[model samples]
Target: MAEIEHPKPFADWETRAYWEGCGRGEIVLQRCGACSKVQHRPRALCASCLSGDIEHFVASGRGQVYTFTVTLQNNAPGFREACPYVLAYVELEEGPRLLTNVVGCAPDAVSIGMPVVADFTAPDRDLAVPRFRPA
Candidate 1:
């Protein structure tokens, strides 16, 4: 299989814990203390209740493929080499959906409602990215 070069992810004050958790081979999410809602794309406040009481925790890294597309063409640097890759929205067991690549299988083998587990890329880098594969 061809290796896909993953660019480094950016981290800010509000998202530092998330990036750090990824580096440790974990998926981090935030929960609102007020509304008891879980969310992704780490933020300083809750998107549901707009409350400042937010807490971070490691996620199960398991989910189902909500939707997906097989990319047979791309001219970008890293993606060009990774033609025929599967990009999908994985609905986490925790509630939020993440836009990520689904690897470790053929593109045609991926389908909606398929079970998957998180996989990390660039673990040696400052931040790792979460990809998904068949569980």
Candidate 2:
């Protein structure tokens, strides 16, 4: 896990699988079994119907930039070296939007409505953070 350069994740029961799957290079999302709506930021109850039935599934990993900003400065520990990066809200193909960093290109090149796809970064051995990039 020497590839990881940031903080490790501390996942609780509700988010355990989501975080663990990322470490294995998979983008997993929770889909409400009751309402059939896919979601991120795992919840015990379905966001649509408030039902306590949810299951995990691999996401398509394809999305469009809804909005974004380039971080010119940050002191949040382990993020200093990643300054001037593109931070964005990506609207996935399945309808869930996630806040993520857009890498693999110039920070200024990112634009609203641009197509993006997932890229995993193992900031810690047991944690793989998902970042997006131009597609």
Candidate 3:
């Protein structure tokens, strides 16, 4: 099967650490120093308490398939060739639900609540995209 050609992800000040961590084969998330709430899609301020004291930490990379769907059709360049892929929201053990793909298995084999672990694509120009696979 042809791999989906993911577009290179660029990082801004808020997400620089996350992109860097992925490049290092680690999944990183943010925690609020004030509320101690963990979040993904890295941001400068804590979404819960609006605190600027957010800290980045390496996540365990373990999660479960919270929900998912198999995309049989996509007109977009990279995705079009990768039909029948599993698109899922993986609920990380750290509390963030990352919108990622579940690979390394048939789409029909994936299910809700299935255990999974982080898998990263080879760094393309210094950035690695995170995905998941059955644990």
Predicted model with the maximum TM-score: 3
Backbone clashes per model, in order? Answer: 0, 0, 0
Best by lDDT: 3
Model 3 is weakest, by summed lDDT over 10 consecutive residues, at 1-10
Residues 6-89 of candidate 2 have per-residue lDDT tens digits of: 666789989988888888887889998888888888978898899998999988889999999988787766676667777799
- TM-score, candidate 1, is 0.94
lDDT of 1 by residue, 82-125 (tens): 88788899999998999999999988999999999999886766
Worst 10 contiguous positions by lDDT, candidate 1: 1-10
lDDT tens readout by residue for model 3, 28-89: 99999999999888998998899999999999999999999999998999898999899999
> Measured by TM-score, how close is model 3 to the native structure?
0.96
Alpha carbon deviation, residue 125, candidate 2 (Å): 3.2
Superposition error at 39 for model 3 (Å): 1.3
- The better-scoring model by lDDT among 1 and 3 is 3
Candidate with better TM-score, 2 vs 3: 3
Which of the two candidates, 1 or 3, achieves a greater TM-score against the reference?
3
